[model samples]
Every structure is written in structure tokens, then in C-alpha cells.
Target: MNLIEKAASRINQGDALSADTAALRSQASPADEPPHAPLVQRAQARAAEVPVHAEAPSAESEQEIAERHVSRQITIDLERLRAAGMITPDDDKHQLAEEFRLVKRPLITNAVEATSSDRNRNLIMVTSSLPGEGKSFCSLNLAISIAMERDRRVMLVDADVARPSLLGYLGLQAERGLMDLLLDPNLQMSDVLLRTNIDKLSILPAGRGHKHATEFLASESMSNLLDEMANRYPDRIIIFDSPPLLVTSEARELAAHVGQVVMVVESGRTSQDAVKEALRQLEGCDIVNLLMNKGSSTPLDGYGYGYGYGYGYGYGRSGRS
Candidate 1:
């Protein structure tokens, strides 16, 4: 079999899940339509239209890779992630892991659909009302879960330039990334991308934090980067682990370029006012999903992370609590 096909074969033979939330699957509507508040400005659902052609070869094109930086492969501590209640292929039956599956299903459905969204619909940003609400935890697991999918490859970008925790969490070394390209025109994408041991996962660290991180995120260079990534590979899904809306202006800036946003709310601590404020900051977004993290009870007892996962406005999903 060809390389990608071979990889897919291995993954399909290796994935399954379980999570606790009372509604994990029990409250799921027979119809997949998620229960979410009406969007302020919904992007035109161009479900039937095909994308226009680009002039240059796409980012993931073989010809482009010929001159691009060779991606360096790295490994993650699957055991560590699992112990913390994150999703792991070795133990997909774990509640946290299973919960993540349900979380990603609808997002993946929207992402892979054939259409031209307000922006790149496949590009999803994961953030929270404030830091310490488990945005990173959810972002990492969501990326891993999507990567495990039989037909998709995932690119997880640590976009929280002010402070990035994804690389550290995955136990992978960090190098140049998003900001590096915007600041130094000489920097190529390959310099920052890390190909992980996971079959369909790759990552881009938040590079050196810039004093103008917010400005850099909204710069023309950043726009170009997102466009290139969106059209690069048909089977690819690009996810941004963004800064919290209440805490930084960067998340708002980043939101302008993506089609979907996911807000993570700490189960008991985050106030309703904070959630409303966070949503207000992302007022222009076409789609928004809320994931209730670290909820009241676990579906399965023995394991930890009482994060009862829920999907709302369609993408009530997140990583291990």
C-alpha cells in the first residue's frame, strides 16, 4: 500500500472510547443537530459548492515539500497522557478518551464537509474564558483524537503566543513556529513544524513570544499562512490552541481568520458572566462550540477527570480534563 494508505490501515485497526457525563450519549438527540444558541452571524452554509482552484501548488503538495524543511518526528508520553485521563490509543475504552470521541465527531463532520465557509471552516480554535480552565488540556486531546481518525491528519498549532503549553504538555521539544514566520520573512514553515510519532498528527509550536504577538497574529503574513494550510491537504484538519478571550486580545485577532471557535468552560469555577464576555469577544465568528470540562461526575468510576464532556452548538467537545 502507499504510505498514507498504509498509515490509515494501521489507525483504523487501532481505535474505539467511553466518557461519564450523564449526557455523554444518553441525551444525544436522535438527530445530530446539536443544541446551541443561534449564531450572531452564521457563515453561508455552502455545503454544495466546491472550492475554487489555487494558482500555486498547495502546502502539502509533493512538489512544495521538495524544497520545504523536512519535518522532524518526535514522540509523546502516551502513558503520561493516559494517566492524566487524556485520550490514548492503548486505552480508548477510558471514559475521558471515549468522551473526546463524541466531542470530535461533529467538528470533524463540519470540517470535512465540501464547502467554502466564511473562512477556512476546517480551522478550529480552542480557547477558554481565562487561563487554567483546561483549554490546553482539551486542545491537545482533541488534536490527538482527530489524528487517530482513520481518514484524517491533524495539524495542532500552539497559537497562544503570550504563553504556550502544548509542546511542554506533549513532552516534545519546541523550536521556531508561527511567530517566527511572521517576524522573520526568511523563516519557512518546515522550520517550525514537528511531525510526531502519532500516525496522523503534526504540531507547530508558538515560536518565540513576540511583544506584538497580537499584532503578528492579525498580520497579512498570518492570513497567508492560514490560507495555505487550509488548502494544503484535503484530508488535513488544522487546529489552533488559542489564548483565552477574557485574558488576551490575541484570541479575538486569531478568530477573524478561522471559521469555527470552541470555548472551554471549567465545570464549576467559570462564572456565567465570564462565559458571556468570552462569547462577546468572538461576536463575529460563524460557529462556536462549548465544552464543559471537569464536570460533576465520571461516567466510569475507576479513572479520574470528572470532566463530563458535552457538545453544544455542535462541537461540545474537548481533550482530557
Candidate 2:
């Protein structure tokens, strides 16, 4: 019998001998057999005795890894976003997480819970009042958050033609993206859709910048793309990360197609007027909700805004009293 067949037979019989014992019994010298021969025989025997199947990683584990790897680049803690509010028992995150059991989870949990039920899958508009407000970060995080849900599909469109960030965030370099789709209207949406290592999330980057970005975004072709996506992936949440609302009318113009605007306001930096003006510009659209980004850091004593966790500073009332 061949060595492999002998090993299999020995394994099936459950009478296999150890490598040393087998070597001593065999006429061939120790130098003759390959070093791993015994190991190979044992492995074959074990496989014959017990069959096994490989499974993919769990969703929770995947999310943990994604957060760990992605959050490393930024100083922001996912927990802080949840536990930064008030401990006065009125904080939204605390109340919601307590009720839903999602508080202990990542901040994305809160975002997913907030957007999960809508039938429309919410074509949400993401924009900041001014540049450097972390709008891109907010957009990407929100998309990742929504995509974490197993039941939901997420498509992120880089509507910020001026300065796209999704491709950079994902570490992919491709010559074609949203611009290619726009330039060639006949191209399939799936052609430009790039799958991410993160599950349930696909990205359509700004293919190429145009001199008239605003006009292209507002064109019927863009509107058709949105419609096709909505129809094709009804369960998918579509997020468009666009330019600052006040800086350019691009986000506002795109809002008409999306139907809802989620304004991301940077705390301590964006002026009240700019925010108000941006809100006014999006007055006609359906606003999913408003989020205060980078609102305030945790106070010195660890009591500050209730991030997703709980208001660290204002935990139990007895401690405060």
C-alpha cells in the first residue's frame, strides 16, 4: 500500500503507532523518512476519524476588528460618542441604549438602530457647514455603522466631487468611479460599485472631478442612478457624502434627489450662522435627524457628554448628589 493509504487505514483502524515507534519497527533508517511524515499520517488519521467544516467569522467579531483597525487612525473613541452626553437621566443615547441593549455595543449600533426601520432605506445627505468639520468621517462612519447590520445593504456615494475621501479611506486606487459612470451613462451601477472588506458596504467614488460638478450632480443621470439604486437594493441604505452645504450648493442640490438631509455640525468651530444657513438651504428636504459631531470632549473628571456608553461624568445620581 502507498504511505498515504497505509496512514488512512491505520487511522481508520484506530491502531496507529507513534512516529518513533513506527520508525524503530520500519527497516528504513530514521534519515530516510521525511521529517513531517509522522505528522502528516496523524493528521490524515484525525481527519478520517472526524469530519469538520470551516465557517466565516461572526458579524460581531468582524465589526470589532473593523473598529479596532479603522479607529486607530483617529483619536476619536467610539465609546466616547455614546457616553459623552448627560448622566442627568435625560441623555438620548443612554436612554436608547438602555432600552435597546445597544449601548454597550459600538456607536454604530446607535446609528443603525436609528435608521433601521425606514422603508425607504433613507437616501440621507451628509454635509457640514464648513470644511474640516469631519463630515467625511461622519459619512464613512455612518455608512459602516449601517452596513454592520446583517439585514441591511449600504451604498456610499462620493458626491463630494471637489475632494473625495472614500477611496483614500479604503486604501484603493482606481482610475474609474462615479465620474466614469456619469461620463458613460450606459455603464451598469454594479460596474462602478466597489465592494469593501467590510461586509454589506459598497462605495462609488467620485470618478473624476469636473469643472461643473454642481451641474453634473444635479443632472437627470445622477437622479436616475439614485432611482436605480433604490429600486435595485430596496433594503440597502444609500448615503451620499457631499460638499459642505454652505460652501457649495452641491449638497443642497443633491438633497432634492435624496429627500432627507442629515446635517453634521462640528461643535466649537462651526458658527451658528453657517449652521442656520445650511439648515435653511435644506429647509425643503426631509431631515432624518441632526447630529452634533465632535461636540465636546469628556470633562476632566470623566463626566461629560454621554457618548454611546453613558454620561461618564454624570453617572448615578447618588454619586452626584
Candidate 3:
């Protein structure tokens, strides 16, 4: 076998060893085991009994790993979302949904119909000038809107390492996600990715926090992870809910890797200078679009909500409507 094949073999072996160790431990009775012996010793004893050249992974072992690595499924509270004026799968006719529909059309077009030169257009980042400007709200709505697409899948990543609110918004508890993937090479994307009851929608939490999160966001591993996320499935759109650009260095570092950015500007709240400086930090990106969120416009529907979209600000603007 070649080096790649050998590596795969070893990984498979390791997985099988892990499964066998668990089985042995579970099967061992309390009277059969010494209480003082470390768990590692028991695992080692089980490993020593196996042949040096073990058989290839069995069908059962593969099934076990598949079951173990399957994404944790979650159910979003549709009623809570509807009550909060957010978009839901069943209520596409709502005004908020209509607004997001307008907001997502150009974004969908950009991702679906991109030229060879367009680098990771499907990997979009959503951020704001400062916190509590409804970036998270916009991020969730945009993700749900895209997930409504017939031909697309959306993965919402909580890249706000400092303050993650996506899980709480969806009424989910803390779990391993993006940070764990960056910190541990053994943790596969399947292990942390959350598969929602919402069709074609997945979520990656911010995972555990690290002091050098800015450096982690800028690392080569992060680049590779982003590449995998962008290219693994051609129909997938990865939306990152990043931190406020002016508030955290991590967002600026993250902006460099994505092809397009949606900077949310709350009407009458975020200062012009803050927006300008935030956009300046994202200068490396090829496509930067502005989203006017939480406006006071009251349409005939009696809902005081509005949104505006700035098509494109960088090269290859012709593709966007």
C-alpha cells in the first residue's frame, strides 16, 4: 500500500482498537477486574492480544464508526422562532421571509454561478461593526432562507469564538464544534457537525475557546478546514457567523479566507465611521455586500421591518443582481 493507503489503514486499525477496547471494558465484570488498574492498562492488555497484522476493518466496525460519527441531530423550535419574528420553514410567506428572500437571491446566484477565478464564493461570512446589531439574527435568518432552497444545503458555522449565541438561540446546549476541530486533529467534521431537523441545514458551534483564537483563525489548519467545507459538497453553502469586525481580531482574520462577506449595518444605530472602518478591515475580500437590517420601514403588512441590499463592491460585480 502507498503512504496514503497505509495511513488510512492505521486510522482504521485505531478505530477498531478503540471499539474493541470499549467492548472489553463493558464486558468485564466487577469481580474480574482489579479496581486499582488504570483504564489505559486494560485497553493495552486488550490491544496486545490482537495480531500485529489485523484484518481490514469489518462491516460491523465500519457501521459502529458510522453510527459514532453521525452528526448529532437537533430540532429547532419553529414556534419560538415565529414568535420572535424570525423565519421558519413553514412560513415562507411571512414578511421577514420575503425580505430574506430578496436578501438571499443575489447571494445564492453568486454561489451557484461562479467563475473559475471566484475563490470560495459559497463560503460567506456574516458580521457587523459591533455586537448586538442583529448579526446573529441575520445570520440565522439567512441560513434558514438558504436552507429553503430546493437545490442547496447550508452549514451555519458559529465563528464567534468569544461569544457564541447560535446554539442558545436555537435552544441547544453547548457541544464540541469548530474550535475542537481546530484543536484536535482526531476530531472529524462529522463528529461535531449538528444535523438539524430542518432539511439541508447543519450547524457547527464555536466549540471550546482558546486564548490565541485569532491565531487559530489565521492558521493553515483553518484554511484547510475551510477548503474542505467549501468543496466537500458542490451544493453546500457554508455561512459563518463571525464576530464584530471592530471588536475582535478573529473576524478580520476570518474575513481573509472567504470570497464574499455580508456586513450587517443596523439602521440608525451603528455609526458611519464604525461601518467604514469595519469594511476597511475586510479589504482583502473580493466581494463585500452591505445588508441594512432592523429598519423602521412599516409596510402594508403592519410589520415595522425592512432590509436593503448593496449588490457588490469589488471585482466581478457583474454576476450579482
Candidate 4:
């Protein structure tokens, strides 16, 4: 029997395979008779388990699929990425890349923990105390780094309604996305997602910025969209490049829908007071991870190695009451 035949046999016998269990038995010889008929029977049996009235898949349009992917995908320059200290799987182990790997661990853990009632744990928002604090840099890099993982897909959303920069950063043109979905009831998510050549990374540009952006962010439609994105795929990490917390109401409003928040603090540039106030704006978030960017580097100290970056993560302790 073939691989499918063994699977069919297992299913027919009412034997469920465990996560670690091998899919097929080696004893099944290639010369064995075709088990196609048995496999169909097994599949039919499994289909019987689903509710007969369960809703069918949404009939998403071809336009939706087409618009999601552009005629040409923007090829990220490897040398530019390396010089900018961004993560690329092909490059040698970089210090910045290593630091981000450590940076993403806790967030990934929170995303996977089923016990947590919050569905937005995987929906992470990256913002800053103010502009030029490296939040965009951090957001892009974080998404790329996470996408490098074999098991995870990254959906990087440009949520900076006030200043949408991801398209420029990625060397792409303006495209419809998050805001468009909210404004137009006819638009589906697949209608605006920009499919990149990057193995597992996709971009969702912040559509035409709305005048009442904050109101749109906190709308019921926005909530539904977020839920759909969160549950559509279990292995996705949705990263939002949000506007500066202190500058835009949309950022503060966006925080309400996210399970985790990453506040970027420019080490030498951002003031302590600004950082405190920026964090204060995200008062309702249960988990806020403070990422200190542009910090001074030190030589190996008592710990045998000096850590260049700083991060603070917690539940409601990050100015989130």
C-alpha cells in the first residue's frame, strides 16, 4: 500500500494519529494493490463527522486573489538588508538578527499559549514613543525575522494611518488594505494583501488614510476584520506597524484590539518622560513589551558578554492598567 493507503487504513480502523506519530508504515510495499477506493471510503467517513449544515467556504472573487498579489513582487535587496542589520535567513548569524530572535521568543510563546483567553496574542502591534524612534525599523525587522521560522507565516500590516511608510520601505507602490476593508463592505482581505516572493511573508498596506481614523479603528467592522485575521490561520503572526503612541489616536485605539504591544524606545534619543507617557497611552493592553533601540554597546562584562539591546515585557505592568 502507498502512503495514502496506510492513512486510509488507519482512518478506517478508527485509529487517530498522534502529533509525533509517523504517517505511514514502512511495511506497506510499493507493489501492494492500489488502495484508492479504500482511501475514498475513509475520506467519506471522516466527512461524515463534520456537521452537515456547516457553512461552506466563502466564495472569494478572482479579483480578490489577483489584487492580493501584484504583477511583480518587490525583491528585497540582500545587501541592503545586511547593511541595515535586518534579518535574512540566508545571511550568516548576525548580532542584530540574534538579538531579534531572542526578542521574538516571548511574543511567540504568548501567541501559542492556548490557555490565554485573548485571541489577539498573535496580533502584535509595534509602535514608538514618537516618530524616528525606530518603531518602523523594528516592526519590519521583527516581521521578517519571524517569517524566517519554518513553521510561521508573517502578515505585516501597515497600521500607521497617519504616515504609511511600509510600501516605501519595501520598495512597493500604494495598495489598498486595512482601511479599505473597513470603508468598503464589498472588499475581502484577500483583495488587498500584497503577496511577496519572500517564502512566508505578506504585506497589507494601510489603505487610504481615513479622516476619522481612530473611529474606524475602534469600529465593529474593524473588530470583525481583526478576528478574521486572527483565526483564519493558526500559524500566522500578524504584526502591525502602528503610528507613534503619543502622536496618533489611531495607535492608542489600535491597542484596544491587540493582545500584545511592543513600544519602541530609542535608547539615547527618546526621553524617559516620553517613554513613560507613550506607555501610559497603552493603558488597557494586558501585555506590553518594551523594546529599547539604539542603546550603547559595551564590551564583555561580568556576565562574559555584553547585551547590546534592552527589552521589557509584561502583563499590564507596562503602563497597561
TM-score for each candidate, following the candidate numbering: 0.75, 0.58, 0.74, 0.73
Tens digits of per-residue lDDT, candidate 1, 80-146, equal 7765666787776666666788878877877766365335878889988887877787788889888
Assess each prediction's global lDDT (C-alpha) against the native. 0.68, 0.51, 0.71, 0.67
Model 2, range 90-204, lDDT digits (tens) per residue? 2334332232122112222322444433323256667777877666665665675566565666677888888887666444564456777777856655455565555666677
lDDT of 2: 0.51
- Model 2 stretches with alpha carbons more than 4 Å out: 1-121, 297-321
Better of 1 and 4 by TM-score: 1
Assess the local accuracy of residue 148 in candidate 1 as a C-alpha lDDT between 0 and 100. 83
Clashes in candidate 1: how many?
Answer: 6
What does candidate 4's lDDT look like per residue over 1-321, in tens digits? 633344233333323211110111221000011224544455547556868798753332233224333323556666666655556778626556667876787788888874546657888998887887677777877888898887788889999877898877656778887888889887666667777767678888899978988899999988888877777667788999999878778888888998888876654456656766776677677777667665544434566464443333444533231
How good is model 2 by TM-score? 0.58
Clashing residue pairs in candidate 3 are none
Give a tens-digit lDDT track for model 3, residues 1-321. Answer: 533233233333321001011111221110001122344455446656878799733222222234223567888998977766678999987666776776787788888888887878899999988987777888898999999988787899999988998998877898898999999987777778888888878899999999999999999999989987776667779999999998889999898898788887665466766766776676667776677655533334555343322222222233452
Q: Of the candidates shown, which would achieve the greatest lDDT relative to the real structure?
A: 3
Candidate 4 deviates by what RMSD? 18.0
Greater-lDDT candidate between 1 and 2: 1
Say which prediction, candidate 2 or candidate 4, comes out ahead on lDDT: 4
- Itemize residue pairs with steric clashes in candidate 1: 18-95, 18-98, 20-299, 138-319, 311-316, 312-316
